[model samples]
Structure formats: structure tokens, C-alpha cells
Target: MSSQYRTGSRGSAKAKVIALVGAGALLLTGCTAEAKRGWLPNVERDTTNHTGAIQDLWVHSWIAVIIIGVMTWGLMLWCVVAYRRRKTDTGYPRQLSYNLPLEIFYTAIPLVLVLVFFSFNNTVEKSINAPVDSEVVVDVRAKQWSWDFNYNYEGQKKYFAGEQAHLNTDGSAGVEETLPTLYLPAGKSVTLELNSRDVIHSFWVPAFLQKLDMIPGKTNYIYLTPQVEGTYAGKCAELCGEYHSEMLFNVEVVNDAEFKAQLAKMEDGHIGEEYDRQPNKVNSVVVEHGHEEGGK
Candidate 1:
């Protein structure tokens, strides 16, 4: 009877292992194409030149984490079952004061993992932020609840000063015609110089899979080549004030002809101006008040 019970326990454990493996495989296969690639839904695999590298790093990192999790859980379960107290035992199981090798392994493994992640991230970041002889440069200025885009191409510059978004009754931002739109020529390298007039804001475009902070009195830049021609949504990722949620913009990646025509139209409309223009007074007052109170 004892031998039969032991055999049955082993079989049950094997069955459980098989079932878990089967379930994991099913879930993996059931994932959508995008989810299978990077575990993200509704996101394209590659929207810019740097997006592929970003997605690769993201997916591989998750894979490494999942592998480590499975191994750790398996070891924990083994410890629980293999070292379990038995009915025939008298006293407690032998206890070790320390495990030098195990301790060293746990420490070294995490350090190695961290180093690996950092190395990959640093490589990708350097590639993305590498300076290029860009065909176009955009000076982006962020204010209380709007954006200003100055497009510089060839010998001409075009500007667009965005207005604050319309707020719905529920306090959510509404899509309005007044929102600023930035146009870029597809397949051309462009650099965006980011700055803030009031407080810190983060320029984020989900499709680009990149975001940079706009710091007051400091300039940040991002360089990218738009590979696809389409309209993409952009917003401030940082919470600056009450209207932070209303800070929004649009990016239109069009062909060279369309980009040139848009620039001409902007020039005709006098939509934007030089960076030397005065900052928004309404937001400036708010910032000034905060500074005065802080000084007090």
C-alpha cells in the first residue's frame, strides 16, 4: 500500500506538470500577432526606424523575466515538497546555517541580469539618440496646456501655435480643430528640440515608442526617421497642472510634396513665429506665483 501511494503521488505530479505546460503553450499560441511579438496589443511592430530595436529589447526582457520566474517557482515547489515533514519522522529536518554557493548564485545572477539589461538599453538609446544630418528640425515648445511647433526645412521656417484643448462637461479633453499639428516628411531624418516655457512636460507619441522630457531652462532632443506615412496622436506624458490632460498634439507623416505644401500653407497663414516670441502670459503668471510662494 505504501509503494502504491508513492507511485500514485509521482503520477499526479507528472500529470500536473504536463497540464501546466499544455496550458502555457495554448496561451502562447492563442496570442495575437502583435501580442506574440511584444506582448502589446494594437501596437504596430515597427513604426519608426528605432521601433524594431525597442520592441526586440522589450520582448526579450519579458522572455528573460518569465524564464527566471518559472525556474524560481519550480525550485520553490521542489523545496516545499522534497523537504516536507513526514509522518514517520520524529524531530525536525536537518537545518543548514548557511549556503554560501546558493547565496552567491542568487546575488550574482541578479547582478548579471541587470548588467545585461543595462547594456542592451544603453546600446539602443545611443542608436536612437545619435546625431544625424537631419533634413528637417523642429523646435517644440510646451506650455501650460498647449504646444508650439516650429518646422525648419531648407531655408524656410514654419510655425504653428496650438490653443488649449476644449474640455467636455466630464472634464475630459475633446478633440478640436485648434489642436496643433506637426508635419514630417516620410523617410526623412528629423530632429525635435524639446523645451518647456513653464514646467516640465514629457513629449510622448505612442506609435514612436519614445518619449522625452521637456525641462524648463534646458533643451532635450530626439532624432528619428519616420518610416510610415500616417497620422499619429501625441500628448504630454507628465502631469504638470490641472490642464495637463488637455495638452495634446498630432503628427502627420506625409510625403515630401505634402510636407512642403503644408509648410507653405503655414507660412501664408502666419501660424507660427520665431522662438524669441514671448511665452504665454496666462501660464507665466501661474508659474511666477508658484515661484514667489516658494521663495517666501
Candidate 2:
């Protein structure tokens, strides 16, 4: 009996050592490997006007989550190995009914964690939705499965209305999937007023790290700044209708001179009367251009 007890104890100790070594290796691998490639592995890469601030909050949140996850998993593994049934056990191990201190610790810790997370999220949300002195305002209208972007420049109503792009009829792929391009000056604040014509739709610019819903009879606002000088993709994030997949758009961030030139060109009888202006109203006309009343 003494020999059997000694042998069983030795085996259990060896098993525990192996488990600890494996757990340590996993922790080291996860930390070093993911750290090399930015800590938050699942978040979208940010390139919007004020997305840097949001990105900071996002990274910190993920770090907190990972730390809690590791600790919780470590405790579970430790409990499994440390209090496991042994082959050399006689009748039963000493079992405690309950510990008030441990119970309170578990309950209180989670509550504190929840509050901390909530506060962090609230701060980030406020920062994202904060108002800014906008240099330009674009009224965005969603209908069926398409987006209409009306740009108001220098106190003038939409001098140019942007809609979905069309491919050349020659069957050649010239600029594949290029949709309505909304031009804005980089490093300037721009406000977008979102309104839906018929059904609900979402305006999402993944690079901007911003999205807002457009509901009928209600106007939603999205304020953002574009910092990059390239075209970024935008899309209707919500499934609205049969052609929902075709609801795609583009955002072109340009320099101040180029932005002004584009607006000037649009005002100089370039867009023509067919692409004429419209009143900026939340509950106004929702007809596509040329399909309007008595429009050619």
C-alpha cells in the first residue's frame, strides 16, 4: 500500500508539471505571435478622419478581454489538475460546502469588470459621435438598393448629385465595381445627413470606421473627417431588397485645391441641367434623377 501511494503521487506530480509546461508554452506563443501582428486581430483597419482615437480604445478593450480570458482559463485548468481524483484515493477527498469569501470574490469581480468595460465603451462612443465644425455637408439618400450623394458647397445647394456609376457598354471591365464617388477634402470635417426614401438602409464606410442607419421620415447624422488621399469603398450594410448587393459607393479624399476645382467644374455648366440641384430636405423628393416629374 505504501509503495502504491508513492508511485501514484509521483505520476500525478509529473502530469501536473507537463500540464503547466504546456499552458506556459501556449501563453508565450499567443502573446508573442499576435503581438507581432497588432494585438486586435479581428478589428477593421481604420483610415477615417477621427478613427485613430477609436482605434486606441479598441486596442485597449481587446487587451483587457485577452487578459481576463487567460486568467479565467488558467484558473479552470489549475482547478482541474490540482483537485483531480487520484487512483490511489481511498473513499473520498475532503470537500467544503461553500466559502463566502470566494463566492463574494467571484460575484464582485465580474460586476466591477462590467462597469469598467461599460465606461470605456461609453467614452469611445461619445468621441465617435462628437460634433465638429464641418467644412462640407453631403446629404445621403438611400432608396431600394442604391445611394444618392448630394454635395452642398460654399452655401450652394447640391451643385452636383452623385449616383451609381455605369460600366462601358463594350463589355470591357473599366474600373470594376466603381460606384458613386463622393468627393471630400482631406483633413476637413464633413457631415453626412442620412435619409431613407422608402425602406431602412445603412451607410457604411469601412475605412472611415463609421456607419449609420437611414430611416424614412427621420434624419440621421454622421460626422467624419477624411485624412487619406485615396478612394475608399462604401456600401449599404443592411439588406434592404433584392438588389441590396448592388448598393455600393466610393469616397474620394482629395486635396483642398482639387476639391475646390471639382466643385467649380460642377458649377460651370458641366453637370448640365439634367444633373441640376435639389432642396436639402429630410422629407422631400426621393425620385432618381431623370425619373423626376417632367424631367427628360
Candidate 3:
């Protein structure tokens, strides 16, 4: 009786520790806030997409996760309690080998669960990968440390961002500045064609939850929607060059009127050209020495 009581007490303590550990693990993976200015927003953090289908699928998958977790813990505890070693422990555990039926049952159950999970996952993948007939498109190219966004608002009617343009400036410290801000009208299905100039680079937007690889020769595609109205920071995901951490772009999702106005302003002003010209003008002062030449 004493041995049985002691075993029960030990089992209780073990179960409490296991529960605490599990809870701690879950808490570690729980939500914590960050600066939200990109493809991922501060509000919707779990499995977000432009269409929100991926998010829905994730919710279903987590249900399975919870169910499986409970079953696993239950089974583990059952085995532990049933086969625990007492004070006068025997030489070895019971000689009961694995049962074929039980093994098959376990295999089949998990297989079926996996298939169910995959069905939802596959559905989402296919839906997302489906051909977009009227999807808005953008081309993107990335090089060492700059991002150039070119929107084809002319004859082709295909808008693209990320063209690998070599930035040249008079100064040697930093290269010329390319397109800094990306403008997109909200509620439009924008597609981006991604490429790399020098090395591999990744264009990632936290709010839009979209990322595309900019390969040397190959162009990749990233599809997303601007769900909300804001300015989001685009970060480089791949370790391309020296300024990996400093490599960042901007995505601005605004209304159609706002986008058109911004584009019109850019066209009329030629901001980039003006920016380049201003620097040369500022540094073009020729210093002439007349009497100071011999005096010094």
C-alpha cells in the first residue's frame, strides 16, 4: 500500500511538471507585438494572406494540432503510469512486443489525419497558384543594396517594380538613390515579377505578408493585396551583400486617386533627376586663389 501511494504521488508530480512544461512551450510560441508597417499587420498575425484563405486553412490545421496534442499527452501518461519501475523493480519490462493490429491502427489514424490536413493545405495552394486573369502585375529587381520600382503605366498596362538598376552617384561613399517608395492602389490584386541584379535578394513586406526571391537571371512572382491603408517597410530577406541589414524598400498602399496623384507628381517633377542634379550643383563651387597662393 505504501509503495502504491508513493508511486501515485510520484506520478502526480511528474504529470504536474509535464503540464507546466507544455504550458510554457505554448506560451513561448504565443503572440507578441512588433512594429507593424508591412505585409503583416499588428491586428491579424496568424496565417494572414491577401485573400485570407491561407489564414482560414491555418485555423483548421491548428484544430488538428490541439486534438493531437491532447491524445499524445494522454497516451504518454498512460504508458508511463502502466510501466513505471517500483522499488523492487524487475530485471526488465514486460516482454509484450508490438502488436501488428495496434501498429496499423496507429499508422492509419495519423495517415488519415495527415491526409485531412493536406487536403485543406493543397486546396489553399491550388487556389493561390491559380492563373489570374485580371491580376495587377509588377516587376521587381534587386541588386547589392538598392531597390528600383518601375510601374509600366503606359502601353503595356503591366505595372512592375524591382528593376535592378545600377545606382551611380558622384560620391564614392554611397551609390545613387533609386525608387524609395512603392505606391499601389488598395483593393487591387497586384502581381510582382522579381529578379536580382548582382546576387540573391528577397523582397518582403510585413503587412502584405508577401515575399519573392530576386534571382540573378530568373524572375519570381509574388501576389498580394493591400488590405489596409498605410505605409509599410519592405525588408531584404536574403544575405546578398555587405549591407544586408540595411537593405530595405517601401510599399505604400493608398487609394486610386492618391496613387494617380503621386504618379503624376513624379512624372511632372522628375524627382529622381532633380535629386541627382541638386547634388552636383551644391558641390560645383570652384575655389579660386589669387594672393593666398604665394602668401601661404
Better of 1 and 2 by TM-score: 1
Give the number of the best model, judged by TM-score.
1
Off by over 4 Å in 3: 1-32, 35-51, 86-91, 154-179, 267-296
Q: Rate the local accuracy (lDDT) of all candidates.
A: 0.80, 0.71, 0.61
Tens digits of per-residue lDDT for model 1, 24-75: 9878875755456445434566678888888888888888899999999999
Task: Sort by TM-score, best first.
Answer: 1, 2, 3
Give the alpha carbon lDDT tens digit for every residue of 1-296 in model 2: 69999999999999999999999987787667435454554233446656777777778888898999999999999999998989998898888999999999999999999999899888878877888778798777776655566677677555444444444577443544456667888888899888776677899877676788887678889888777788877888998877676667777889999988777665422222232223354244427644432111
Backbone N/Cα/C clashes per model = 1, 1, 17
Lowest lDDT sum, 10 consecutive residues, model 3, at 268-277
For residue 6, model 1's alpha carbon misses the true position, in angstroms, by 37
